[model samples]
Target: MSAVPQERRLVTAIPGPKSQELQARRTATVAGGVGSVLPVFTTRAGGGIVEDVDGNRLIDFGSGIAVTSVGASAEAVVRRASAQLQDFTHTCFMVTPYEGYVEVCEQLAELTPGDHAKKSALFNSGAEAVENAVKIARAYTRRQAVVVFDHGYHGRTNLTMALTAKNMPYKHGFGPFAPEIYRVPVAYGYRWPTGAENAGAEASAQAIDMINKQIGAENVAAIIIEPVLGEGGFIEPAKGFLPAISQFATDNGIVFVADEIQSGFCRTGQWFACEDEGVVPDLITTAKGIAGGLPLAAVTGRAEIMDAPHAGGLGGTYGGNPVACAAALGAIETMKELDLNGKAKRIEEVMKGRLAAMAEKHDVIGDIRGRGAMIAVELVESGTRDGAKTPDAAAAAALAKACHQEGLLVLTCGTYGNVLRFLPPLVIGEDLLNEGLDIIENAFAGI
Candidate 1:
């Protein structure tokens, strides 16, 4: 019951007839600002593949940017969500409250990193969770400055836009960002000015120095970082980097927040990516993989810090909708019963093995990084294999287009737009995963 029928059957052309017609309709109705990587429209999605309106089955390499880790149509999610739908939809937790909402918080408290006394507050999305975490941190420390890494992506909201690092599509033209936000260096191994071996210590030292000189530690409320950067590329922070930052935050009385929106819930072979380095943050923000594709997010933290905000200062109308809570419960149960963490680790072995063999032949692949199912390959100029790396954004785009044409869905990201990320569902079948990788290999060969 945990598995979906594993196959990559193409019924028509990549976009086919029906999808093309819908694409035309979408062009007229959808906002010009909103963008989709592929022009095709999805009708059904589950383990391994998403079926388009034209009946083309494309292998899924992007789980809605790491949302559906339990697969899109997981049986438990469907069952629990269906029962809740029949009972009652929205009573507003702030008005009457519900057991489902409390249960989700209980799960968050138990599942998030740190064995210390913990508490949680649910929200509707990752961005909301992040914003709330910041609120709690500032209130707890009675400080104004919030520090974030150079390549981290928080959200699209105005305050989060200020928190985010990128300037193109995410932050461009959206000005007057929130105040008291400062940018610092992240331990990106591939692009560090120093060599990869020195990335951790060097980056940490530089970050701490900046915090002390430019922004006093006493004025800082929190230090937020993504253990594995997502939209900025699937860059896993260099080993020892996170631990160093965590210690510095502790010494300065600054709340450390691990943004695990895209790296949590077994997506990285661990419940939380920070756990890999034993970097237990005072606060952890989660979404994306929390509720089996439903909208749900949470900020779990030490009880003392989380309680800093008054009752009326937190919560929203749809913070923990009963249906979403039901889906989250089902997703957690499915992750445990299916042992998704083990699956993610196994997938890392399979994918990294295949990608390494390919890298041996292809020089354009400048780097291979990330943990478990959440992985990426950085593409650079084909000839600069041993020289200064030059990003190959064109090659990344071309590879993704080639994969789409062959019924394999892939996504491109990174500050340089040179990273081809892979986020296959943990429940995907081995045959399907290898087949998808084969398509990627073939695309690279053609390139």
Candidate 2:
């Protein structure tokens, strides 16, 4: 069936009777540090709705943190994974390689933006892909320094943590980060020192000037960035900023890496967000939505740079696990068959329409921004007229809690923790999608 029927039945309170009982058990058994954004527990999910253990069906706007883009329990994915399971689960690609791994790499080269000769290496997570990209860049350029933008999120590993801009949840107490990593300012027009009114070219030129002066282009091996800053708010770089950086990286020996973890696979109405500007990075790191929930990531780049790293240096024990590769094949097939890029464009239309209306009605909504389905609404304490003020984190947290109570799952992101990111499955039915958006509007109304 193209659309699954959804019924929002709340038999008990949000956590419901069964989930509360399990939550208590979970607290006793699970580590305390592992936190949850929503208190409700999910038992089943399809399309865009998550059925809680307590029988309350909540619309899922988070998409398992943007991992399950094809949707939870997609039929094709289940069938493909099931068939692959019958064949064999793992032989370790490094020890005994498989066609599934090779097939996935081939697909990556074909699908990722760029008409040039491209090569790919599969990994287990975004962090692994990013680390390998850096390794390859350094090996190819014979440079030690890597430059990342401010408010960019790479991953949780020691090296990626050093590359990440946030400190509290990601880097706190995890000290002694990797060396030779540098940070530069991002073209966040909302908070830019020069302001957004200036032309995109001017803003980009200024940012490039800062990078050239501070880091010295010759010493840098790579400049890594997210086309749309994922965790640090879904801030799209100013128009000219990405092209300028890409050109600079080319002019110098620096390899430009686009971290497409949260922005790829038709998430932004395109196969890759970098395609929006026709800016091709030397390397692209992708994960989250690549495998329809399977743990799979890839670093696709120019063949020369990718081949610079020795074969043994680019692989991992679990890299390109057969099962994950099979899942990716299914996911890619599903994306193409279902025309998810069109779905993402449709999602952008709905999101822009509703969020723009919401921004008008609500004073606290400072800005509504994003491209395609990867959209976010930045909440400010006062309103949009008072400039880009940080929204009250406590209030945003409370709003999220209220949405959870009202049978809707949402996630909060941003450097200041005030932006609400909407990552609904591209397959979400219009009814359910509108219902979830309505729930958000209601929560904001209550606020």
Best by the lDDT measure: 1
The lDDT for every candidate, in the order shown, is 0.92, 0.87
Question: lDDT, candidate 1, residue 439?
Answer: 96
Query: How far is 394's C-alpha from truth in model 1 (Å)?
Result: 0.3
- On a 0 to 1 TM-score scale, where does candidate 1 land against the true structure? 0.99
- Per-residue accuracy of model 2 over 1-447 as CA lDDT, tens digit each: 433347456678887888888889999999987899876777778788888887788888899988889988787877788899999999988898899999998999999888899989999999988998999999999999998888899999999999999997999999899999988777887776567655366766765787778878899999999999999999898888899889989999899999999999999999999999999889999999999899999999999999998768878888988988988988899999999999999999998899899878887887788987899987888654366576667667878888888888889999889888899998888888898888888998898
Deviation (Å) of 99 in candidate 2: 0.9
Off by over 4 Å in 1: 2-4
Tell me, by TM-score, which candidate is best: 1
lDDT against true structure, model 2: 0.87
Q: Please give, for residues 1-447, the per-residue lDDT of candidate 1 as tens digits.
A: 434346888888878999899989988999999999988898788988888888788889998889989899999999999999999999999899899999988988888888899989999999999999999999999999999998899999998999999898999998989999999998898888778889999999999999999999999999999999998999988899999999999999999999999999999999999999899999999999999999999999999999999888989999999999999999999999999999999999999999999999999998888899999999999888567899999999999999999988889999989999999999988998999999999999999
TM-score of each: 0.99, 0.97
Model 2 is weakest, by summed lDDT over 10 consecutive residues, at 1-10
